[model samples]
Target: MSEVWAERQRRTNQLVRGIARKVLEGPIDGNRLYGLCRLTWITEAYDAEHPAYIRSTKIPALGDALHQNFTGRTLDEVANEVATQLERPELETLVRSHTGFTNFYKAYRNSAREWMLMHEAEITAIFQRAYLLQSDADAQLLGADIAALPSIPKANHPHLLMRPEYLLTPACFALDPRLRFPILNGAERVQSVLRRIGAADRSVPAQIQLFVGLIGQNGVRDAADLDQLGLTALDGLGRADHEPMRQLLMHVPDEGDSLPLKDEEDVRRLQQALDVAQRRVHNSMTNKLRQLLANWTLLEGRAKDCRYDVLVKGYDGGDNDLLLEVKSSVDSAQIRMAIGQVYDYWHRLMGPSSDCHAAIVLPGRPDTATEELLQWLEVGLLWLEGGQLYTSTEWLEEFVAAVGPKK
Candidate 1:
């Protein structure tokens, strides 16, 4: 048996590694994938009889083969375990030091896109650039067009596939396994997250109003939901024309060491206001979706894939089925879950079932880490037969609008 501290550290390491693994390679289509990848790396040998692993004699245990054929303990486990060991206070240290992929992937985000160009270094450039290009359509004004997005020339840098500020399509990226990286390197990921979940804006706060022109057009119950949106969900890349304002509300906890205000009520009032505002946005977003989707199918439900989170899927006839993933999310896990659902949606649509083609929609970009949650899975940027992932704002203005707004 291992030392108690070592055992504790090992478990924590496993937890972190496991989450990162899911972020890089999940939607866990079949349990076989999970057993093969996740359980195989442990110190204990595989039972081989586990249903998830051996569905049939023909199915090779990629997990088992990996453990036996590969040398040394896997980095997926090693990097995380090492950090737990090296960091003092052991498990507690690891918990605090460890960051989920949602926060880490932003290092890859080009500055200022995910967060309205908030980076200190690029704030100046973003301001200048936004000024030069008043509208994304003003591309001609600056003699700049969206050049073909640069593809990842190397592995472990999938976020690089998504350019900043400018919008992205799923085809713009790939979901190859060679992109996998060690999950334990949180420090390295900081830069990646910053690059991918940036802080620049194409237009100022007022430009969000364009979406409002449709408030009455679509019978939006409470336009306040759009008002409540914080613009952060579309943090990495989007246009001001359609990004819902709910994408912008970020309630950062005050990290200051000193509480200068003597009145606690002041803080409470401020928080109360924010909560009410966010809730209105939340409700409005759901109501608007429900209103927009009443005719097709139920607008509220899980992806039939990841039920623990908010996801909606509907049956549409022909190649045009509908599936939506709802994430009141501020991170990339939403992206990963949406990716998995889209893959499954494709399979369900054209694979075994004869359902309509579907749409995999989300309220925002996934904050989940691509290095771990989306590993080994062939999840590209778009769905099979050309489906899309969108925030509530984008869905209302672009994809859903394609079908026309609710009367």
Candidate 2:
């Protein structure tokens, strides 16, 4: 994960763990359960499964089913309506039979409140035990105990309800921030990431534990950072708007640290190399632009901790600012990285000031796909070809008229 993202996660963790200490770990009550529903990753997974009902109603259904509050009465009415709906002939095929409908009604009729009352003590005990987890054995047992939880409720699929991995994992992490327990959507995506990184084969729980350990070794101190690693690995490469997957892809390990830097010296050396390379890339691009374009003021731009390669100020002696990011190569990976980086630098660093533009400077002309991607992002492109500077069609007219004809 980039330092920017890691820092964001750190701030988020502080808030999350603070809430856990105050709301989740303090006492068992409606507010505590409501906090889990509203403040944790469990909310997303749960809402996806129960989109038919809003939290104001569903949470009370889960926690205070027999109460006389409006929420409870509304939920009770909903359960009755659902039972009546299940009696329809069309739903019989989907729901199995009258007996199945009866069971489904009973699951709700019995109320999530009743179920919670029966198992709340055990669930809380397991959640508290997360603070004491010390080894793989402890994690395995925790995973097992969580799996033993009665069900992961589904408003739409009564028969399909099973273990609440999504809820339990986040609950455990919230209670025991030290464990950095990953918020699991499911096992398939985690398994896919492990395979893509060439991690050894293992059970889903073991694989997650392995990833947790790997990220910790690599200086990832937040659960959100681990999630970012998986997201970048899984979706970033294929999606242009995402952070470049190459950042994570370049460091995958077959048998060691996910991001392997043997020691402090190795990290220092890598940073030094990157700094030198960036300087050369920026300097060369800046020098070439100086020779190619006339009557334009060029300088480096800085915003907070981020730096732009070259900032072209007062274009054509006007107030327009054009920010350029120079890439040393035109490969798809380089272009993709350039796109994400420049877009971030442009929107975030440059802000939404009027008459400001952003573009990528490349060593050679990119292919059709790269051009299309940049065009879709509404980013201008400039490349070197046969000792001449070339701009994308969208920029060519402006360059010819305002910035002087391309050399």
Candidate 3:
């Protein structure tokens, strides 16, 4: 594994161990306590399975143990019932860490309750960590990192059904490996446990909300999920229009210390955003030019299956039309491209029309070399300055000198 994956696993293992310690230290009630153990068992089974179906195969038996025999029962009673039904010596050993089937419930019941009530939040945090680990493991098995997985969509009243088969459908597994089962089994376990405990109401309990928040904090690992988290966070802060926050949220990792935003990925995203903004500005400039000019109609120009930004025609209707190529900025690259595009547009669209003219429009003026290049090409130049559009008199004079005045 790469160092990044290794670090991810190390952090996940640390959280899992911490959760286990917290669970052992608390006096959680039997049902809630066993719920945590069940979660652990589900995770272990999912990870250890070769064919992966063993995870779901065991769920029905486990559910029966929880709902029928162990409901409202003490921890000891639940453990004994599970041991009897499972009857697998190896399974008993696996669960012994949490269940302690060898010990009687009467010995620790009162003490457990006291510890649980005193540190409920801490105990819940343990479960939260477990849920996160499960999510991480699921993501790993799916050939994805937790930082890239999309967030679970919010439901007003999310169904808590423990349908492992549905959760581990072929489509889910197909995203990574065809043979991998339990693709999203961890999330299913969390949701199912919550519903089983009658905690699936719209007003999610504080503990459950904490779990969700933890997932949002550490679960998102993909661009879509990052976008969702950003939008959600922005909505919460009433700053939906804030660009910096959106950028930060989009790149921030779900786990590990965040690095400064100076990486190539950040540059690429910024460039993409800039390209979009520049295109919008270019289009707006085209529209403004259309509105400002008189006795001239500007439409999109297409020739030889190539499209130019604007095509101009006089109301008198001769072949003396003008072709305009708009650029977001007056860089050498944009200047070169604009000149070539205008020439091609005129050659292909206006064909043999000596009266046609071509111009390059930009949001800002270019340097001396760029201006000279346009003059040499005999192309007209129009640029924006101080919120006003201005035509380059020098470019017009060079155009007239080279091509002569319009007939």
Candidate 4:
């Protein structure tokens, strides 16, 4: 069993190195390639551990390192720093003996060197072609060719070879679909072929190990009993938060499978964290707006099953009220959702009255298309720029006029 596991590890490393080499040979910049490799290693190593271990021990240490050294630094620079730190005898000993991997550092270096040597000719040829074409389409075609390679192991799944969860590849790919690589496409589609193989011949334990690494023990009972999990808010959060939920969900064996209840709960916890972060930003914007509208009455809009972050009523004692939906950043989806939500709240509280104007308030302005959409919907747009709140629509102007000019 150990021998089989060792061989599985070797084959997986081979595939990863092959894909990495292909990318290296392509027109991709150094920063991106370094980022890809760094994330791949982190995910491969970290996912292999128990979730409890990660949450309790790994996260604190990792978080500190990230907060201290990784903040505002490029991944390539961070990778170098991490490599330098790990080379210290004391740190290396502490990591190897305590973490899930047994002699992980040594094994990783040895396997990487071995794979590079073994795939030198293939890697060279791929690089040559990549340089000759220098087009993303050509790189993608090369990936397809690599996926079709007859010498590659057919039974082993690509998900195991490249754990997408750790590298943020799935989320990055989703945000900019152009980031698609042949290796990723292969990994995503391998399960279909794997289904045809005999259950006995299939590497169920390997699959289980990869699953355990990606999702943690709480998400699954055993390797054989696995379900699909979706990381919602991937698209919404992808722009602001580079590390996305899709990265966390990429390790699921099948894309179609449903997540267990535990995984769903974990996702809920993540959503709550995001809400808190956004609220912090919203609060800052609210405070600034409140100061500006000192004479006008500012009240929180509350309704059954819904709540508005802020509502501004004019000092003129008229029915004219401004319903503001505050967001940290107004992406297209957020604006769309906010528009519907504002209408729902207004109709429930005020009941179909033109006396109230709905506006989407954001920390930053949205794109021209999103701005146009807001105008068409008759939803006013307000944003903060250079430490001042600015408005684009006539409704906002009326609301500001009621409060009078800045002191």
Candidate 5:
């Protein structure tokens, strides 16, 4: 099993590196561009309706494309291969018919050549510099060069060279045989990890350099190993050992601290503390909902990384559309935290188009100033008053009125 896995990894890396070299060489054509496009991971993968739904779903097709003799194929032929080869007819139809895909594919095949022809020299030079980035100064110059590249007209969907992660950084990784540059496509995960580990530098280029530095400081073999560790830590997969990987992830020493500590341990300690404190509040909220709003079922809602407390099921027992975050106090800090949590739970966790309701519950009523702030942000506020639940938002008031028994 281990041998097979290693061989698979080796082959994948070889393919990626080969494409990366081709990209750095000038006089790129449609076939080479198509290969790069297949290598590029777009942000639209997050959208289920899009052709590239989950990135992994296209892996087989991508592998076929990489290995096939597809030199003279047109854009339509490439799309057809991507669609029909995947064993999913629906995806084939989507690739062939979806307007977003059509727009992007047309733009890629028709316009990419002209654009690359115009900027190929500058692009190659920038990536060559990125290949040997040594210090912060080098990284900064590379970033500036990329930023200064003449802007192409924005497309309805992303293309091969659309974003830094889509092409440049990956190409840099491919060009460098040592795999120094870790892919920054998952920048949000990197940012979250930095915050969790207590790093102060949040800029993208700085973050990339810091990651490379961490790879060396922690004795990581290469960017490939670091990338595996990242997926293991963030996406919760890959075969990297958990305890040692946790140490790597948590290596940044806290301010005024002597040495690095396991960040997962720190997070566990903090989470345990929060859970202990929220136990009573959760129980009280549970009892109140059970007594006052019996019809609305109470459940827990989970996002990718964390779970939000108290999902109030819709009246018809349909979607859990009402998200309630319980905080221990009505203090300014707690209110601010609740606001961010509820908003993230509603907008990010539950899709922005979910038409969900979210609110913060506190032990006591907030001061007028705090109330005004909540109102200004259009966040609903609920509090405990005289052994009963009370709400400041009229929609909430109407909801309770319509559902719960009189008073």
Candidate 6:
């Protein structure tokens, strides 16, 4: 057999086995399966209901339009082809005319890259345990394993961990409606896809290794190294041993994807963290807003990750909605690095309908240094602690009352 045909057979075998294990694992939820599809195929095969639901849970307008005007077969039965898997019509409509897919792809891809780095829990251990056979692997093998894994490539620069440049092409996938699978408990199904693909379990292919090295090299422009990014070169790849391919394998959706909150306790914990952050910002900012009608809101990171110590609000909200972005750290090298995060939030906040303001909650007394940063914010500075946000005594009762128990 020719080299191309042989490679195709190998990939077909891997995909078949992968799909088999995924099926044995259980019938995946439509949404989770849609996420997996984003990696495996071109189109993300979500029906009106799923995307509508996702939009509601995340963005109401996105959900509403998703409720309308999206009906395609998603499959070409005769030829077995899938189309428009990564493209969301409603979402595309919202941003396409403005920034177009080029910008959207860049932003989404960047977001995914940052997210993978954030969930850097015992990815190695998870891979080793479930897949087995990782025992006593030497440095080269371990490096190969890291390089081989597609989702998170261990870059040539070990210190940088998984660099973003290694992300695979056709970087998104949708669902295949023709196949019947169980609806996941939301992102759980996506996570399962990561595990099954050996990305979660640390299995990877060769492309990811090169991709990692390439990304690690920053932006080297050597012709030979860059030649592998074309569509034809990607045709036979199924994430068997490619480094960039592993990223495609493991890049599942995480936002607002959680199993049902099992009990009141779970709800309360989520509420407490949310409430503490909310009230602290509110009380601290009310006075500042009084100075200027700084339109603002807040966005926090997943409470679990420790990359950033705190969340803060800055002025750049949409004309109406407050735009807040989280800063992972404040002590970076650049003078404006931390402040720029706070600054960007303010810029996004100043929408057609509102004015932008800003603030950063320092873990310590940012007194003199932070004061200098405040000149950049429309909303003046204030410290964050229990007493400042509200009466020291009223905090618990107020926080709980403001944040009631879940239904």
Q: Which window of ten consecutive residues has the lowest lDDT sum in model 1?
A: 168-177
Instruction: Give lDDT tens digits, candidate 5, residues 58-146.
Output: 34324433455544554467557755554444434433332211112334433544554567667657655664566555665565565
List the candidate 3 regions with Cα displacement exceeding 4 Å: 1-274, 302-304, 315-319, 352-356, 394-407
- In the range 1-407, model 1's lDDT, one tens digit per residue, is 01122223234333333333332232333222222222212222213233222222112222221222223434344434434443423423433232211121333433313232223233222223322333423322221212222322212544545332122110010111111111111223223423332412223122222333322321122222222122222221234344221221112223333322211232233343234444343344444454344333232221232222112232223224344433233335445445655555456434765532333333344334542343334332211112222333322334444444334
Name the top TM-score candidate: 2
For residues 162-244, could you state the per-residue lDDT of candidate 6 as single tens digits?
A: 33223322111011111111111113322343344344444333333332333222121221112212222221133434422
Candidate 5: what lDDT? 0.49
CA shift at 243, candidate 5, in angstroms?
Answer: 13
Candidate 4 vs candidate 6: the lDDT winner is: 4
> What is the RMSD, in Å, between candidate 2 and the native fold over all Cα?
17.7
Give the higher-lDDT candidate: 1 or 4: 4
Q: Could you tell me the TM-score of candidate 2?
A: 0.42
Give the clashing pairs for model 3.
27-112, 147-221, 148-221, 148-222
Write the residue-wise lDDT of candidate 4 on 324-371 in tens digits: 777656666566667877887677657877755788888887889888
Angstrom error of the Cα, residue 106, model 2: value is: 19
Which window of 10 residues has the lowest lDDT sum in candidate 4?
Answer: 245-254
Q: Write the per-residue lDDT of candidate 2 for residues 128-233, one digit (tens) a residue.
A: 5765556655766777777667874554555766445545565465445464666554545444666655553554476556656644332244555565455323
- In candidate 6, which residue ranges exceed 4 Å CA deviation? 1-19, 22-50, 53-207, 213-358, 362-407
Tell me model 2's lDDT, rounded to 2 decimals. Answer: 0.49
Per residue, candidate 3 scores C-alpha lDDT tens digits across 1-407 of: 01122222222233223333444454544444433333322222233224232223223223422444333444344445555654533334333232110111222323433443454554354333333433434433322222122222222322322222122121122222212122222344334433443444422223223223333332333312221222222212222233221111112222233322212232243353245455456556655655444223334531223456655543224545566777767767656666766787677765776664888888888788877777777888877665555666563443223322233
